[model samples]
Each structure stands twice: as structure tokens, then as C-alpha cells.
Target: MIHSQVNPDAAEALRGLCIGLTRQALLAFTAIVAMPLAAEAADGPGTTSTTGKTIALSNSYNGNSFRQVMVKDWQNVTAQEIAAKTIKGATVVSANSSVTEQASQIQNMILQGYNGIAVLAASSSALNGVVKSACAQGITVVSFAGIVTASCAWQVNYDWSSYGKQEIEYIAKRLNGHGNILEIRGIAGDSTDKDISDGVHAAMTAYPGLKIVGTVYGQWTSTVAQKEVSGILPSLPQVDAVVTQGGDGYGAAIAFQNSNRKVPIIIMGNRQDELAWWKQEHDKNGYETFAISATPSISQISFWVTQQILAGKTVPKKVIVPLLRVDQTNLDAYLRTIPPGGVANPPYPKDLVVKIIDANTNHSAMPPVPPPAP
Candidate 1:
């Protein structure tokens, strides 16, 4: 009877072991079946989600609205991409208007193993060494707005020379090829500033009628521009027009208004507040001018180009983003969509960026002629 009981107990224990083994096998089968589906879910359509690229944005200055808007837009776009896992992450480093600090910051980014670096350089040529080092590590570097002179880094910018010439030409025509214009220049020694100034001077020489009566550095900030222009107003001659390198146009206009002088035909940069004021002035006195400036959204172009490069798409060493022009016809439209005191231009369309990548990927050098503005 005792032997019979032992046999029954042993048989029951054997049955329990078999049941546990079966449960473990079922779990293993489920995990194996789910692996591919899980991977597909992690990837977004048309993206190498597995690549997990990381990018850094390095800027030398953050005091102006343009840079502020640029950083914000970049954050918004990259945040979405990060959620989709198209890229692993993004970082922004600001040098507080110092080129040396910016260079060091990028060196750290490279050492941290970032896949790409996007920069609005503080100095056009100062950061070349670090940029080259980053490129040597197989990291992509893309610059925009205020570009770098590093040949290894890709550059994307609006045609500042064209911007200057066109803006001055418009004012020149309004002045009938002759006027004493006040030039509110951007930061002294900035590449963008130099290019725009060159364009303005070129136009002035070609027309032989427009004279730059006074010049002051606006430093690319509205408040600074207003104060500087105001300080210089008392000793200046009759200023019939104001040619500016984007940032100071609105401030320059305000200075004339504050002094009870007739507000001149001031060419405007694409600042939202500036555009709003332009529309109001248009309503009040039929004030008319065109908008041309490096849109802060040009940073988006740099961001996209960096992305394409990280994805193994070959891109041109230099790519040009066109100056965004907002005229009287479209002024109200921009005002309707843009925030009060925000930036004016929209983010670049994706389809256009794709075309740019496809067109320039094979270029061995900059085209002999400047590419037409898109």
C-alpha cells in the first residue's frame, strides 16, 4: 500500500514539471513571432530608423530675434523627428556671441560622437579647424545664414549679394535712381553684413545717383539699431531712404518716426513685427517696400541637408537657399499666419529640399555660375 502511494506521488510531481516546461515554450514562441513586427513598428516610413543619428546645432549668437526663431524652429522640427525615431536626438550650443567659445563647443560635440553638426557660425573662417576635424570623423557639417568658410563643411545661405542689390535697386527706382540713403548695416565684419554691404555699394555705383549719406552698425538687433540710428540722426542730412542688412530696417524706420521726420522709403527685413508695422504704415500713408532678408528658417535648410548627409545622401559642398521675398501682395497673408513679433518666412517645403539634394549630390565643386535662387 505504501509503495503504491509513493508511485502515485512521483507520477503527480512528473506531471507538474511537464506543465511548467510547456508554459515556457509557449512564451518563447510568442517572443520569436513578435520580433519582426516590433522592429517594423519602431521605424517610420522612408526613414532609416535603425540608424539613430544624433545632431548638434552650434550658434555664436542668440541675442537677436532671427537666432531665437531659428533655434525654436529647429527644436520643434527635430522634436518631431526624435519621436518618430528618424533621429536619436539633437543639441543646441550657443557661444553668446563668441567665436572662440563656439569653436570649443563644436569640438566637444565631435568628441561626443554626434553624427552631424549644424552651425550659424560666429566667425566665417574661425571655426574651420574644428569643422574639418568633425568631417574627418565621418560626421557631416552644414552651415547656413552666417556661413563658415570651411571647404569640408556644407554651406546653405540666401543670396545676400542679390538681397543687397535688389533691395537697393528697389529703393533706387523709387528714388528714380537718385537719393541720399542712410545705410543701417549689420554687425561689422560679419560675412552676411559684408556681402549685403557689397551689394548695396555695387548698386550705388551702378546707379551713380544714390548716395549713402550715413552709416551705422545696427549689430543685428532692433533695440540697438534704434538707439544707434537715433544718436546719429541729429547731425545727419535729409535721409530719403534707408538700406539695411535685414535686422535694423524696422528700427531705422522708427527712429525717423520718433524724430518727427518723414519716414523714408525703408527696405524691410522679414521680421513679423516689421511686417505688421509695414502693413499698418501701408494702410496709414500707403507706405510701400519689399521684404528681403535671410529668413531664420534658413536654419531648417541646414538641418535638412545635414539629415540627408547623415542618411548617406551625397550633398553639394555649397547649397543656396533663396532670399524669401514678401511684397505688398503677400504682406497681409504673412501677417495673418505669423505671430505678432515673430519671424515672417515659413519653413522650407520638404519636396523642394528633396530636389535640392538630388540635384547637388554629384557636384564636385560650386557651379561656375551661382545657382538661380529657388
Candidate 2:
């Protein structure tokens, strides 16, 4: 048998190459392990994923159509996020315009370990203590529609004062700055009500001839508005026009009708029934007026804002959402989109919410409302 001679130098080279490859492989693996995982990356560098976060809504009131629509919007938006695995879960709890009850609800949410809570406040200041406590626990709080005064809570707000002023301005123009105006206010102690009433009273000073002959709190409910306005109509002179804080215009018109008085220029609050009544009157006699209100879809925006905060994005403490206005020019278009007994609720998808946040960050104007579908 012939024996083959082994090359010791070649053997040493092969062993060295094997060790080098092993070292390189280990280095690559370590680098990868040190990098951020896909699950933790979100929005941009330094941001964290919101996938594991859960959010909740603490609503103050569900008594009116606007509030009902707001709750429905929150459910629809949060449900979509949960189904997409963007958030772990979400829930909504509503109180009947009671500050104490709302505070209790928020306290429960905090104890339940929600990552975020969106509040439709019952009072501007009553819920501040609970809101601060949530913030101290590192939970994000977003207050919308009826905002709170907590410094740590983010607010998605509307220009309620502008809404009120617009109504009075339109009435003054329609009546040529001289009319007996009937004023319809909303919930008495609500921050929104106070803001709008202040704006209305402030704007009324510009036109000395325009006097507010009657005032009634409609509680932003049509039935309540109708009954209250009816009760006050007999004692007052003919009302030339009515300036309203939404959800009460159609009732004011009904009150006038029931009292056998002529219906004047009643500013609508963008409710479906109110729009329908306006359309009927418009068709019959070319009656014209304006409608404006904060869209209930602000709930959707609030949800996205919370999601962004959970994802480690820096958002402003106060984000202003524009009010929805329906004019005689596009009343029919808005009317067609609303349900039989619902408010005008536009959708607020995540992308639009991002734009709104970015705009607020840059101190620019928020995006304008899209025109109604044809």
C-alpha cells in the first residue's frame, strides 16, 4: 500500500480561514441583535410602535344627536385600529353630563391600565384633578368637544366662539342689521355654551338696532328648544330672526310654526332634521340661512392623536379642528350625506389626522374641509 504525504502548511491555512469566517458571522449577528426591531420602529427614528397600546374614551354626555354621533365615531375608528393590529384594544364609557360621574369613569380607566384616554369633559375645570392624575401616571389624555383645563392633557378643539359669532353676523346681514332677534343657547354651564354666548353677545354690540328680545336655553335638544321657545313666544313681540347655538334651530322654527307665528331666518346647527326643515322652507319660499357646528368626527381625530402620542410622536397640547359650515350654496349636498336623525359627521382618517398634527406643530392653519361628494 502506497501512503500519501499530508501538507501541514495547507492544513494551517484552511483552519485559519474557518476561524475568520466564524468571527465575521458572529459580528454580523451581534450588530443585527443590537439594532432596533421592526416591532419597535414607528413613524420615524426614535418613535416607538403603538401596536401594544390600548386606548379608552371617557365621554361626558350622550344626550344629544351630536354626542351620539361622536360616540359612534369613536367606536368605528377604534374598532378599525384594533382590527388592523395598530392598537391592542379600546373601550368607551359615557356619563350623563355629570362631572363627578365622568371623573369616576376616568379614574376607572386609569386603574384599568389604559395607555390613553380621550375625554369629552362634563366640566371645563371639574375634571382637572383626575386628568392630572392620569398624566402623572404617564397616561395620555386628550380632551375634545368639551375640553378640560389640565395642562398635561391634549385638547382637540373647535372655534366655538367663532361659531356663535358667525350666526349673529349672518342674522345681522339677513335682516339688514335691524331685527328683533330671538337667541337660543345650549347647555347652561357648558364651556362651549359660554363661549358661544359670549361671542354672540360681543358681536351683537356692533349692530345697535339688532336687539335680543327673547332668550332660552335649548340644552342643544330640539324638543327642549321647541318647548322653551313656545313658552316664551307669547310674551314677546314678533321675532324677525333667531340666532342659535346649533341643535336648536329646527326646534325654534317648529316653535314658531306651532305658535302660528311666521318662521324667521333660523340659523341651523347642521343636524339632519334641521337641514331638512331648512330645505323644505327654502324650496317653498327661497328661505336662506347658514349652518355651522363642530363635527362629531372630532372623536376620530382625537383617537388618532392618542395613537400618535402612544407611538411616541410629539403633539401639541391644543389642536384646533375647524368647524363644519353648511351654506345655502351646498346645503343640499350636506343634507344628502347625513342620516335621518344624525349630525354632519365627516370621516377623520389617520392620514388626515397626521396632517392636522403637523400643521399644529408648525403653527399653520389646519386643513380645510373637503367638499361634499357629488
Which structure among the candidates has the greatest lDDT? 2
lDDT string for model 1 (1-374, tens) is 22232324667756655655565677678779877666444322224433488998998898866678888888877887789777898988888988889999999999999999999898888899889999899888998877888888888876678878988879878889887888888888776788888988887788888888899999877888899999999988898888887767788888889999988988888787788888999999899988877777767777778887776554667786667777787778777877777777677644566555544543323222122233
Cα deviation of 201 in candidate 2 (Å)? Answer: 1.1
User: What TM-score would every model get versus the actual structure?
Assistant: 0.77, 0.81
Full-model lDDT, candidate 2: 0.86
lDDT of 1 at 11: 73
lDDT (tens digit, per residue) of candidate 2 on 200-250: 999999999899999999998899999999999999998998888888888
> RMSD, each candidate, Å?
16.9, 12.3
Clashes of 2: 0
lDDT of each: 0.78, 0.86
